[model samples]
Target: MQQQVYHSLVYHSQSIQAWEKRWFQQQNSSYGLMQQMAWAISQQLGTLFFRQKIKKIAVCCGQGNNAGDGYLVAKYLKQAGFQVEIYAAEPGSSRDLATAVQEAKQAGLQPYSQFDFQTEYEAYVDALFGIGLNRQLDSNWQDIIYGINRQNGLKISIDIPSGLGANTGQPMPVAIKADYTFTGLGFKAGLFTGQGKEYAGKIELISVIPADTELQPIAQLASHQIQLPKRQTFGHKGSYGHVLVIGGHANMGGAVIMAAEAAFAAGAGKVTIACDAKHHTAILSRAPNIMLRDINALTVEQRIALIQQVDAVCFGMGLGRDEWAKEQYQAWFDLIQNSDLEIVLDADALWFLARQPQILNSKTYATPHSGEAATLLQKGTQEIELDRVAAIHTLQQKYQGQWLLKGSGSLILEEKLYICTAGNAGMGTGGMGDVLAGMIASLKAQFKQKIHLHEIVTLHALAGDELAKNGQRGLQAQDMKHAIYQVVNR
Candidate 1:
């Protein structure tokens, strides 16, 4: 059995099933694995109930193997002297499940008087469905999940929550919101990414069998610890790297200022700002180190000259969606598109890319939150949120570049995939995206191949977490400057 740990591999539901099938094929009793899982779960449940002084628990069982686990858990808990009652959605359909039901009955865990579960208990065990469920739940299942969610008891889900796709992390119309989800077999991708963090709650990975050597994990949970290279004693400003941050419309100078500052905070040797001259004074006032170029005055030849001077460019912060913004976008975008400079496309850059779809180079990084992702993919925000892992992959496939889909579980897809689990709700304020754009531009320019895209993203999230330590409520993106400096130096 695998022990629960943070920052492990995440797999699809099919991989989990494949491992199970292989285990059963070796003449190992499938029923035995079911009992093993239930017993382990029952042990954990007993400890929790004992500590909480919870004596009464309602185990709601469906017709599948998941219900079999529920039935066995009720029996084990009842034997431990808890007031346990079993309620089934239907009779056990599988032979092993039926056997589990009978064994539980033999252990004296009889069915509750009310099958509809009218009576409340100290806690509730959700076993209505598992990873096998992908399609939208019908009215009956939805009603069941809804009723369970309405209950005030401590809710614990067996395996994945009912009505949630094990692959997509999407609730199928409705799903149980568990206080602790004791996921058996392995860590499912849906249980870690997308909306899985909300529904799954605290996760405990239980291994029923050893993973097959052939199975490959879809993504890795981003590590909290990040180590950066130490600065050399002989290094000067030009020895580090130069980052050019483009965008700051006549009305929106603040975006360019934030991005440029973030670049400096992330340890860029030299940072330049290319925006309207109206914003140059403000940019220099806030960050005296940042060189400025008036976006309106720069000719195409000068644009190419500027691109050549910088190792990386962070584009499209605060560039408004207007005629002037569009014209600036076209001139800069075309030059940047044809050039080999490491690029970070964000905000209005993403907007322009959506308007004029282009196959980005491998060196480019595109960061889009759910809303921006919708614009880029021509899908609704809710649709992108439904399955963020899939959305990031889609973005990468459509536009050939490193993609970061920012949300609760920030998905990163470069050559492989990664899910960032470090950020908090406090990092949700305005201008946070600008901060991230700057960080990416600065780091890519400095490190180049010395670092990975996922590492840069994790570092950004870590910076956000550090700022959130004071409090997430009023945390501003501007506050990230100090946090980034603190984290990078460490």
Candidate 2:
């Protein structure tokens, strides 16, 4: 048998629905596709139960096709000798659901309207709502969802976690927090970005639709194994490009130093740092390979002359909002405004851009966290986090460049949106974004033939995840340097 590889192609609800309609047209009917989906779910559940030695399961059903899937799961579980109980919510909404209820009843399964919080089960299957949910849950459903969450068991959601917006990834006031989500038909963009990552845990894509169908994907999720082209064996240091890192005001020398170090670690042929003259001695002491330029001492013409020699530039790490920082930014901004130099803007650079928006080239990359993204978009941090996709699009529209929204499931908006799936919570500390900016700049410098924004972001996150293997807490930004070297070599 050929091994199956699932691409991280994500679709919205309407797109999925349209594809399903086409699939159903090719098949016998919608019910037939539903049956195939339920069968697949049952088989998957059987394997899970066997491995965990689970005997009892509670299937939470709503008044939709998702509920019908729950009913079928109940029938299959009962037939497989597991104790199955179906808890129906808002019954008599769909004929398919009604048929499923009758069939499950025939298989000696009883449907209950109310659930006891005290009752213990091996697992709970959330089929309350799927991708079609748009409004908030009512008080009755909220109570039920709350009850399910309060239960002590493995919670699995079918298709999608109930009450999560399929496109927006916004959760209802009370949404099911699933331990595992078997997303059917296709991978929904909502399951991997923004609030979706919190609600939909351990996602497994279930292919209910045909694999060869001509369905278009709205976005792609990053893969684990990334491959970069091999460098020539006889190539000299000049074969790879040089990366210039500009940041690190007086007290914030560590930010720019870390970025410069990361750039060297990420395979930049030459790494240079332009910052306050005070940190020059300290930077050389730590990283001797990194050449230093005193931004305070150098004239604007001299800085531009130096910039002209570098392949790529990374700005804003520890770059403060002071007058000195503004002067440094202005000198470089003036030289690189119309130039095709690959630029990675981060930290205070983003704040600078927010204060005064600039016309940047297509080669520019902005790495902004929620707060910085909100500043750039003129919205609140909460608003930016609420819908990251929309925020990234808005950022791209306002500023004509690639944008990376940094957080859990970091999104890269270039020609199309690509969600990074390799990072962990341990990367939440300071200086991490600076490290990412350096890595991106280094890669951009080395691979001048094409822009690898997606690959660069994925590698950065993968390095963080590799470092997080020890534990999430106290995983420093510097710890990822070795991992970055390893990933770049791979």
Candidate 3:
């Protein structure tokens, strides 16, 4: 069956007025304040259903309307018989702390000192700032944010965490890493890209203003949500085609392990790993459910024979650009080009193809992070960061097929482009790229018989939003595999 995904329309603004108009429409369209309040109340009620009462909650207030959100949350929690403490700013007093102070007085919540927060609270609410933040947070504020993070409790962000830039997905020098970020209006673009994904925990948008009123320009746009295709009860294993994972060197078998595991988790019917002999056992040990093969045992003819049966192939990962790995890339390239199978190139494969840009113009996708993307295009990271859309499109035009540019906000491009508004900054850890390649490969292989490149791109982007369930911090590509199943099956 073809993978199903929900895609939202994105618009670029030439002036402030244009953005304002768009913002007003989105804010009221199921993403406004009523929606946010409903979600918040529902979540709290669920906790209450389990007989877990939130006795004490902390609200970090800021100057913007986000601070207003925190104030409101604190008031509600206090009214619900929960103890509420509001932190207007840093431990010390500031002239600019007027909004927080006024809100605190009005809500009857008291300001907290650093020493006074030794007690554990049931939950923490962040209302520091929203998507409009551009400047970096100062050192003193960073210390405060760190202190709050170190505390043991359920932390919630109103609108967005303070010190987070809602546009670039980059965090301010000091950003409050929330366990859950209640976004305002429509989804903000920056929340899912760059470091934004890691800091903005489980995200849900809340539009506080009426949908019909004029609003500010959108700081960022939310990507489409992934919806899994329904399966027929009569379907068999062949319903989902085979996925071939090609990678894993002697000491780096873990690379193929991660890739294959992700593919299988994404519901690939048959996942085969053509990797180094030394690491085959490791792959099987970690994921005994997959089919692992040794590349050393297969001749070029044998490898090609196996490749012909698979619906899609994932290249790179632990495969070094040495003689053997290079030969594998060549063989894989010839096999893919010769056949009609879908392909996804990553890691060393992308690096190898970067040396020969002509080869990239195939029915394949090159999944590269900022550094890898820059290297392939012979440009600097700054250039790619400045205009991710242009850079990815340039690469797409340079080569054929689709382009999955991994970074702050992973941009998946085909005829049109998509940006994942989910995800967090904490996703900058290792092994994420390998897992992403596996996901694309699995989805492509499963739906190889149906859908076009746009569907594949849509699935990948939407799956990203689903991965935010467990929070964006320390999110490996492997984490996304589970989310894919949930989305596809949902």
**Candidate topping lDDT:** 1
| Per-residue lDDT of candidate 1, residues 57-129 (tens digit) | 9998888898889889898889889999898866656998899889888988777532477577889998888
Runs of candidate 3 exceeding 4 Å displacement:
1-51, 72-85, 89-123, 151-153, 208-311, 317-319, 323-335, 359-362, 369-371, 377-400, 405-411, 414-443, 449-490
| Residue ranges of candidate 1 with Cα displaced over 4 Å | 1-7, 113-120
TM-score of each: 0.93, 0.95, 0.63
- For model 1, give the 10-residue run with minimal summed lDDT: 1-10
Residues 1-490, candidate 2: write the lDDT tens digits: 1112376788878888888777767755777777778888888888998999998899998888898988998898789888888888666567777888889999988788666533689899998887888788888888888889988899999999998878767777767999899889789988888778888998987786565456788788876667777888998878788999998888789898889889988888999998888898899898898898887888867876887889999998988999978877777775776567888899998898998998768889999999999999889998887778889989999988888998887898888888887788889898898899999999899886364687788889888888988899999997778989988887
lDDT values, one for every candidate:
0.87, 0.84, 0.66
- lDDT comparing candidate 1 with the true structure: 0.87
- lDDT (Cα, 0-100) at 59 in candidate 3: 71
Question: Order of candidates by lDDT, top first?
Answer: 1, 2, 3
Per-residue lDDT, model 1, residue 241, is 89
Candidate 1 clash figure, as a count: 0
Q: Give the local distance difference test score of model 3.
A: 0.66
Candidate whose TM-score is highest: 2
Candidate 3 lDDT score at position 101:
52
What TM-score number comes out for model 3? Answer: 0.63
